[model samples]
Target: MKLKQFIAVAFTTLCLGAGTSRAQPVELTFANALSLPQVEPYQRAVDEFNAANPDIKVKMINTPWVEYWQQRRVDTASGKLPDVWLFVPGFGAEWLYGNKLLPLNKYTDADPTINLPDANQTMLKYMTLNGKLYGIGYDFNGQVVYYNPKLFDEAGVAYPKDGWTTDDLATAARTISKKLNGNGRKVWGFAGASAEWVFEGWFRGFNSRMITDDGKYGANNEGGAQTISFFMDMIKDGVMPIPDQKDPNAQAQSLFIGGTAAMALGVGHATYIFSDAGVDFGIARLPVGPAGQVGTGLGGAYVISADTRYPDAAYKFLAYITSGPVLAKVVTTGVPARTSAWGKLSDRMTEFAGKVQGFEPFNAVKGSFQVMDIQKRVLSEVWNGSKDVPAGLAQIATEADAALAKAAAK
Candidate 1:
């Protein structure tokens, strides 16, 4: 072979090698606000996904919930949203309606391997907007009463059961407080927090709607007044903690874990926290009001950005996290959104059998609503006793109606 023939052959080989190296895997960014124990399940899912898909690389970005939304707003305005992110139904509404999120129907419908129909129907409804699915719910959190068994035993008071009413709750709380308050160890019947999401259960128990069907404030009505008055009476009766008694930083969970309170209304996550704390705790359904048992469901979903450069890759990651196998692993931290995943979750809970109770009540919660910022502000003022419930709720209706009207006009 001559020198010219050798050079030509070498050039061809070099071009082929460059083309092969250019076929690299796509990289995607997945952002979430989950921390610590709750985050472990998510990290596990991400690791499994990365291991399974060598052609796609997923980078997990963890942010605190407070800063997460603020940063998302900034990212949205500048069109720098991550390929995938975790979002609650209410907060994610703006992004979905603004066309900033990718509609997941095409991917979900075409994928035979994924049993999308097995997901919790109520949760799936929340993730849908304008007849299109925007995201897939990974887990759900619902309200339950976390009570100390030792406290109840010490007071000689029977533990609360399903169908117990507000009156019963007050009686039990009063009995527990009275029996346990004699010593230096101060004990309260209940620890109340200022979060509106938690109080919605009480309002619903009275068969009241916080926001009317028309989207205007409705908490000023008969049921709302009754619910508010009952809580206020409890506070006056010395059964529930007052605003000044609660530490701003250490909320209900901390109080319960410290054994300072006999009972507290908390989310499903409290079961895991209590179990980890080695507290002899039990869970019960929220005490019923005139109507029946009711509470609010809180959870989030995995979504893909509309502006993502790799739609297929992003969808794959979203589906992977919400799939039955992955969700089963995460369900121990919260309720699974997939009905099939519940079986595996039950198996996992065996390790925590007698330590935790009231999981059924959390799973039974099927209703939920999105409370606006203005609504939260008014409710907070009322809960803190700085404003009268009727007056504050009426003001909320007026302002909320005006805002809705203005938006409608635009």
Candidate 2:
């Protein structure tokens, strides 16, 4: 499909250029999961950094998110790794952290510019192995609800507010679905990337979770059950489709861009894509559940690969990427990762400014922790499966116990 959005940022200032200084260049290799507009900004940042210190040169390597892992694993086995790398901390992180990634706590203590105290604790919580820090963050993403404004106006439903409940939003989504489409049109009221992330919002709204505090299967817990039942209710209400294509790989952004679905739970990186479509859209916090409001978090932080030849240089890259200058480029096109930079791009979401009818409900809901517990993969064997919903949840918990045990045994 044609790209629904072209990143609006200019590359002139953010492009790679010559290294400054009279010293020999110390080249560093940076690796990321995929090609994104951030690449240019990163490249630009490298140029600026290199200009200040002519001794350092940098080369960036790009790989698909899916394929990135396969390459990393192969590289790890052979002892060839990039200097600066971005990788998740749980399932994949543990592997590299165990064998290859350098412990970041060492530099965190020695580097004055690298403030371990100010570093987002949530990221540290995930990247730290037992008790030591081992990574730096490139971006921090905040998620919200993205909806079509034109559809809402035609549906004649009142626009959603920040404190709006799930039921209220679902009613509106369903109602809008019926009204906006001509008789027998195929438009869906709401759709998204996956049921997992949406359910993450649901559990948070209800002030609950799919796993226990100690990371046990609590999928059958009252709160977890409520979260699941709510989606099933949405399916019955025609606000959501039956669990047919819950593939973790399916994208929520595509659904909105293609206009196949009216609303979705979206993260910060999406605004660039959605806004590019020239369709009217806006964002708000995820809807409130019967219990409360909630949100989930994810990251693309910097980690010092154990295979990195220059640990100091990689650590320098980590700190540089999270600074204010780099963040300006990130938040404008993608989501903001730093507390200082959070909400910087809210004004640029043109659709929200023009229509005044999108994502208001999400804005009302309070934000919360986005944990990186290593349990989702085990749970997905059921959630992303064709098994009966309730039974699948029960089995998720059981399987979680088994997986944790297996991990512990090692």
Candidate 3:
């Protein structure tokens, strides 16, 4: 028989047999960096999807965050990528440019039921590459200052407010340190991590473009130099802790939680950690810098692999997982990307409703641009005080430009 005739006959046979014997469901793999403890909402969403779609089944794979990137690199090289995975736009740009992941425009545009339009346009813009949508942001977050109210009251300094400038932060930190330090207490006014994300927030505050609008390295410019110099001066002036050369995040968290530090720069989730640690803390906007009160938003996205055998099913699953109702539950650590889901998140924040302030500023600021990967090491040198700010940023520009050029060539 001809191929068309055989297919017609096979379809009829399957239809006739459908009532008597069920067909095997299409199987797809979904992978992410979230650990088991943090994946309850995702698992629940998957369960609901599986229950509703008897013809498709999704298996979830989770890898530790520390090892996920390296493992994904190997998986991409071998064409072993899972059907769906989680990614960060800033870090996943090279992979998207290389076509390791599928462009989601066709899926999003063709599906009338898909709610991609409801996502924050600013965040959606970040997930786009060369005018093609590559992924959907699952959550949004940026930097905020978490302060100890008891410390503020004890030191007779008012809590930092939304429009406070960096100089104001320095003054508060200095006052707190002078009043509480010595006398065997060693209280620190501020604590910050040496991580790239933290530095990116400060850079944005100064209106510095780490990677210029045209995509060349520009971290050695005046704004960038001023940001680095300001933070280094904070450490030298004995207001902020000299961040640990290694594991700066852990050190900062320890100082803040142990009551040795009165203030710490952190993302939204810090509220929960401080609450759990029994710290009487309140949130505040990041201090306004030379440019204004601007900062960067860090978030995650859901991406599909280009080589998936089940593209249509994968797209359906993607839409299901990121839908407002599902994402409302999925977002525990950060703000949901969908405006519709914000109410659900506000409900979750009930524990600290009256105590915390400045969350409004985080929602208002959007990430300006993704920092180049090379900025981390060079900025670390400046933060750790081993290299002069000017010299380190100059080296950063050269190294970052070379890296960008090499990636472009690829």
Candidate 4:
């Protein structure tokens, strides 16, 4: 389609009924925050959707993650938001509560081919809030520890198993950190100890809640203190590095890719990076603490703007891209959000399939993003040993409770 034609179609906001016909195909603006290299798979799915449905043409709007939120805010205020855009449940709470996203329940109810029943219920539940479905999840992810077996072998430590305790993890980590390579290159035992989501995962493992079901702050107790102490001890023991608090994910990924970290806590998508780097690793469920195994879940979905002119076409594209087969093929890094796609996943993450739960409890609340901001800032101090654990947790509780109360007032 020509640029002019695409622009024209994007502004043509007629709600076409089911089975409606038109001489020209409906075009939609599909905005995504994925970076250039990471988006090829999604682009391929878009191409497939455009080719198969001659009646709909979806145009790509690529915004890298660094500038995505800023651009999205500008677009939203100017009434120029894309017809369909990507949504992250906890991170996009501002958009959700502002009522800028179109509810998908009606469309899903009318369209059987969308196959609402086939999606992972855990991911689907996150996409819905206050009885309204805002988006259809395409992929699901959670923080899991990926370990280097060679490092474990060299250190004479047993490889971490699915049901391993946090104590078992500490033993392996401490042992591995003590071993140096032939050239005397130091290899840390673990990375991602300071990452916000990874920290959340450990806290979950300790049965600590960051946010309660009632939407209040809940991480200021004994469990939260123990979780903090655990990771702090790891860093103090020289088993983990003090990561860049602002961008711990990148640092964690870098350490693991460089083979300087024997085991790293990362999201399910980090497998792709490890594979691309030719790193030898084994996936293990997060270690069990008193609460049993647990970790933080994060994922993305396709959502329509409430201001969209082409709701029908947008819904069509949303449904197509998020379907089982397309997601199974395109979402190589993360687990597809459809139950039927589970069988197609490779053996690397097969054990995690049906075993790990990817729903993040904080995403259930109204001001989670604000709460997370508080978490990231305050916990950085705690992680660096500049602030006491008890003090940090108390500050988080105060700030997060205030943020939630403010959001509730709105």
Q: Which candidate leads in TM-score?
A: 3
Per-residue C-alpha lDDT of model 3 across residues 178-242, encoded as one tens digit per residue: 99988678888988855455466576678785555455665578898888777788888888877
User: Which whole-number lDDT from 0 to 100 does residue 400 have in model 3?
Assistant: 69
lDDT of 4 by residue, 1-410 (tens): 69999777666644343236557888899998885665898888889888999888889888888688788889987999999988877667778778899998889888868777788666677777799998988777777788888888888888888788999888888888876544767898888864354466677778788777687877799988888888889888878888677887788889988888998877766777787788888888888898877666657788899999889888888888888888887776668888777777866666555445654533545687788789889888987889999999999999999999998786
Better of 3 and 4 by lDDT: 4
TM-score of each: 0.74, 0.69, 0.79, 0.78
Task: Write down the TM-score for model 3.
Answer: 0.79
Candidate 1 residue spans exceeding 4 A from truth:
1-22, 34-48, 62-67, 117-122, 154-156, 174-187, 244-260, 327-387, 399-410
Quote the positional error of residue 273 for candidate 3 in Å: 2.2
Better of 2 and 4 by TM-score: 4
TM-score, prediction 2:
0.69
Question: Considering only N, C-alpha and C atoms within 3 Å, which residue pairs clash in candidate 4?
Answer: none
Off by over 4 Å in 3: 1-25, 39-41, 64-71, 78-80, 110-113, 116-122, 182-185, 213-216, 331-335, 339-386
Q: What lDDT would each prediction earn against the true structure?
A: 0.72, 0.59, 0.74, 0.79
Q: What is candidate 1's CA lDDT for residue 2?
A: 90
Residue 325, candidate 1: Cα error in Å is 3.3
For model 1, how does the per-residue alpha-carbon lDDT over 211-287 read when each residue is reduced to its tens digit? 55454555668887888777677777777766433332246777789998898876655667777788888777777
What's model 4's overall lDDT? 0.79
